[model samples]
Target: MDHDHDFEWRPGETLEVDGEAARTEASWFREVLGRYASGVTVVTTMTGTASGESPIGMTCQSFTSVSLDPPLVAFLPTRQSRAYAAIRRSGTFCVNLLAADQADVSDRMAGPSDDKFAGLAWHPAPGTGAPILDGVVGYVDCTVEAIHEAGDHVIVVGRVVDLATGEDTKPLVYHRGDYTTTG
Candidate 1:
């Protein structure tokens, strides 16, 4: 017979909140969180092209290094993306941090269509045999450690197998859905 609002659970359902509350809270949280600034990246993987020639495949943002001892990196791909599926099935990828001047490359990889790696300067990274961006601030080549679902995205954890560092490049940042560059 307790009518307390904090009943430890919703009075009559599995969800703690109703639909209206979910939308309201989600929108509020999204707006608050979108204010955070984050670096941009063009994560890539090697694949066979239409001519059966090898090429690097790419997608923008969503890259991070999670651990150093085991040398693990993490990146997320919105689960709905075709490239996400491809990267998952391919079982390997490289994280390429974008230089401030490489915003165009980042945007190009963000798309779902067209060839992404064409003319992208790169060389074979050992272990994964993936293409690491030639001008990136740094690159981490890894094999996936784990894949889990988070919100609307798939959390990908990669165990670093090899790494390379490029010449000093100012990091490209993204905030409020806009690119920011400052030297």
Candidate 2:
């Protein structure tokens, strides 16, 4: 086994390290990473609510397609996220790709609110019972396939079970800590 302790690991940048502390290096690392643009998505799941079942969602930009043969996808959520916990319990989730006009929805879901789904319209995904937002560009229903611990986040690999595509629309993009629409 080769242990590479001298390598400096950053989220989206590579740097050679002499003696810089991780905390001090993280700010610059994060700023550099922000230069990379990424599409915004809301990862949602149905959870037990007082009346019946309600949707819990959180905005995430770390989603990606992992495999095509086995139909795998993945997203990273912070360990402290409540929505991630609900998704884990349900064993299923839906990835809602936001349209450029859906920034309000993304903001609402990303915040720490008891009723994130309040005033939002959504329906259950046919296969997984996950909540799929109405105005998203598309949605992917998935079952939890695997989970790996990564620092303060968990990488959740999901097996895509069902999906739906909506009309062509500008995708919501995040770059440099702000939201924008792609050309």
Candidate 3:
């Protein structure tokens, strides 16, 4: 309820509600958070069709490891995310960590295209039916554990069921609206 300590208000830009500053512009929040560099990932899930199953995926940067002992991971997806909606129905998903060379994949997945898996080579994850993209730095296959509503995004907690890593691949990083590779 009290979010006064959650944000740093700009000078002369505070909104007071009963002597507490209200929420600020979403763009301002995004701009401030974009300064930090983050690794990129393609979160994928499978959706059943009239004939068979199909892959649905989206480029996501709001992903992180939550625990090692329990093998937990988390990603934030916007409420309007169609891929996430399919993932929720599937009850399983995979997070494919992108290599530096996979920026094209990231761009394609991040777009509004209906078929993000077009022209991409992928296989089903062993533990989950979610698509595991080729040429990624690593993959984390998981089952949906919990979901928490946070503003316009939903924080999805996943219990990792399987994982794998690729060799000699540089991670793709996003910083200040641009993509870069680590040294």
Candidate 4:
């Protein structure tokens, strides 16, 4: 298969691959890597204060700190995520590190709901004005620095403008398809 073109695989949908090699490899790769534990975050952005505009966000496990001096952070959002499209348009975002008690928030953001912020208490991060969820363990407010394409996701690098620790609580973690917290 040619690697020049793009490929996409959606959940519950089958791809018409030339052979099972690609499919099998994808499944095996996911299974093997699922064992590595990671903290969860909700990457959020607000496009505008217009009548119909609302905060957009998605729960992400692929978030990490990328630099310190010129402070940078990165998060991977699927290419097809509407939330990501909003983030790109806004050119700024907030990464809310979830607290262990906020699993419901994670599930809500991860779903296909049109309004993920419904019934959730949150305030805007001062730097970017993106929603900083109320019970998050911490948050990083940033402006988009760069974007790159990955397999099914796009890597977003943000230049940190502001940050702060929120409630003193254990971080929400995901591992092997389950939610857990550290001691």
Candidate 5:
């Protein structure tokens, strides 16, 4: 059974959901999606090496596993993120899945501070050299596989190079604009 055209749609054809416009107002979109809970992560990377090397990181909730056969993962980062710019330059990143008790760490990485890593305990991921933040639930170290434009964010596909889980811990979560955690 050839499924080549299973999802094909003609140009100029609009997609509708229950007669509602597929393109909703940005505020409404965000408001509705806010109801969904998501796990938190700090995406980290290193730029340069030795003496001048610096760590870059930003709190992210848009992360997911994309594949298993070849080991791939993805995260969406805003185009204007300074840390993302450095990650793009370095061509590698580590996604540190925040533990429930790491809300402070998340706040630190999410801010506009010049040094997000200040006072943070972490070590370099052996495969990518990206920071593996201490106390995280888990981490995924990867080399950038591909980047695709997605509205104001970029869909970054990373080929997993190394990954591991930390001590069993509940994950940090975000829902309706507040921090939460699994039971």
Candidate 6:
């Protein structure tokens, strides 16, 4: 068989190797990605619990626009998160881009606490039906189209149903495990 091993340190090393390779690929990736800036978002869905049935939302930095014509967006949620499970079951959600001053809200929602939504003012978005948070940068409601399993996270693809941008929008940023704001 023919092969190209341009990037390989030792082209035929694999044939002679017997033990596990010592490397920190995951940590390296995390460190590299920390240098890049990303906007913060809240992915919200209705929790099918016994309580009053309010929208369940979580603060996330993994969200982005996918398409324009059909209107799409994508986000990755950690596979182990309870919020991810509920959102997956509901099959609908909202992506709320946070404003600069909304860091407190984001921090609160990202915790493991049970009552994250309490005292937070929210209004239901029309069409696909996801709650939109006030004092945020913008919002987009979506219906789950496909959820592809990635390594430790699941890539959620959603078809956008509605969208709205606030008048005073300031993007909240995340970098190196720290929150930032657009200056």
Q: In what order do the candidates fall by TM-score, top score first? A: 4, 2, 3, 5, 6, 1
Query: All predictions: root-mean-square deviation over Cα?
Result: 9.0, 6.6, 6.9, 4.1, 10.0, 9.4
CA lDDT, candidate 6, residue 181 = 81
The all-Cα superposition gives candidate 1 an RMSD in Å to the true structure of 9.0
How does each model score on TM-score? 0.77, 0.86, 0.85, 0.87, 0.84, 0.83
Off by over 4 Å in 3: 1-24
lDDT-superior candidate, 3 or 5: 3
Please give the distance, in angstroms, between residue 176's alpha carbon in candidate 6 and its true position after superposition: 2.3
Ranking by lDDT: 4, 2, 3, 5, 6, 1
Q: lDDT (CA) for every model shown?
A: 0.69, 0.84, 0.83, 0.84, 0.83, 0.76
Point out the higher-scoring one by TM-score: 2 or 3: 2
Writing each residue's lDDT as its tens digit, candidate 5 over 22-56 gives: 33343366568888899999999998756799898
Among these predictions, the greatest TM-score belongs to 4
* Clashing pairs for predicted structure model 3, backbone only: none
> Could you give me the TM-score of model 1 versus the true structure?
0.77
lDDT of 3 by residue, 85-140 (tens): 99899999999999999989988987778788888999999999799999999999
For residues 1-183, write the lDDT of model 4, one tens digit per residue: 633222223221123434466657766776777789899899999866568668888888999999998999999887878888999999999999999999898889887787788889999899988999998899999999999999767999999999999999899998876899999
Clashes of each: 0, 0, 0, 0, 0, 0
lDDT, model 6, position 173: 89
How well is each residue in 48-126 modelled by candidate 6, as lDDT tens digits? 6666576777777778888897888998887767778888988899999989888888888777778788889988889
Show model 1 residue runs off by greater than 4 Å. Answer: 1-28, 48-53
